[model samples]
Target: MKSATQDKRVFTEQETSHYIGMSRSFLRQSRMEGLRKNRTQAPPFIKIGRAVRYLKEDLDQWLDSHRKMHQLPHEGGAHV
Candidate 1:
């Protein structure tokens, strides 16, 4: 069986928030902030008429782009 996320190529704001583990308000705020800054602060999205949609591929890429493989050293110089 396919998950709901896997079944859709595009998602609404609410579905996108659930899929990406972010709050709807945060996503909305990001878009607004991005617009003010003339840059994107959130995952790429599509705007159709008065609706917004996020592509599954863009979401996956966005998550991957934020990946951190190396751990930063602590201020105390301890691994923990």
Candidate 2:
């Protein structure tokens, strides 16, 4: 059987920030806010000593939930 560490994936703060196109400070702020929404103490995350790592799947879901779709000027045929 594979070890737990082998099964688990980890990403550095910089890597995650670059992937999400956000500043490292912003990511730290979000985490500091306690991810306040879930009933059972927000989403699960991995922490390596003092450094924190986030799962790609969790980040993707968060992005999808916060995504916004705007209609184009002519695509939706809006009268102006």
Candidate 3:
């Protein structure tokens, strides 16, 4: 048996942003863009009525899916 505090893994928008080193706007834009493009790599979030939350596992998977290889110096200009 776990306490409510111990079982809680869902993160608020701000917390998620802080954890991922992104802004809330960045997360929101990513989510919206994914939906518009029908992409599955977007961070999966839960909407409980008007309240939104993100699961740690989902965020982690999303980060993993977006991983990229290192580029040589001046290989390419950073985008986003």
> Where is the poorest 10-residue window by lDDT in model 1?
32-41
- For candidate 2, the per-residue lDDT at 75 reads 62
Q: What ordering of candidates by TM-score runs from best to worst?
A: 1, 3, 2
Off by over 4 Å in 3: 1-8, 36-41, 70-80
Evaluated at residue 43, the lDDT of candidate 2 is 31
Model 1 pairs whose backbones collide: none
List model 3 lDDT by residue over 1-80, tens digit each. 85453355898888888777788987888777776545344478999998889998887877887787885577467667
Candidate 2's C-alpha runs over 4 A off are 1-9, 35-44, 70-80
Q: Give the TM-score of candidate 2.
A: 0.58
Count of backbone clashes, every candidate in sequence: 0, 0, 0
Q: Which candidate is the best by lDDT?
A: 1
TM-score for each model: 0.79, 0.58, 0.64
Candidate with more favorable, higher TM-score: 1 or 3 = 1
* TM-score attained by model 1: 0.79
**What clash count does candidate 3 reach?**
0
- Candidate 1 lDDT over 1-80, as tens digits, reads 87877789999999899988999998999987775555447889999999999999999999888788997666866654
> What's the TM for model 3?
0.64
lDDT of each: 0.87, 0.64, 0.76
Residue pairs clashing in model 3 are none
Error of 2 at 45 (Å): 3.5
lDDT of 1: 0.87
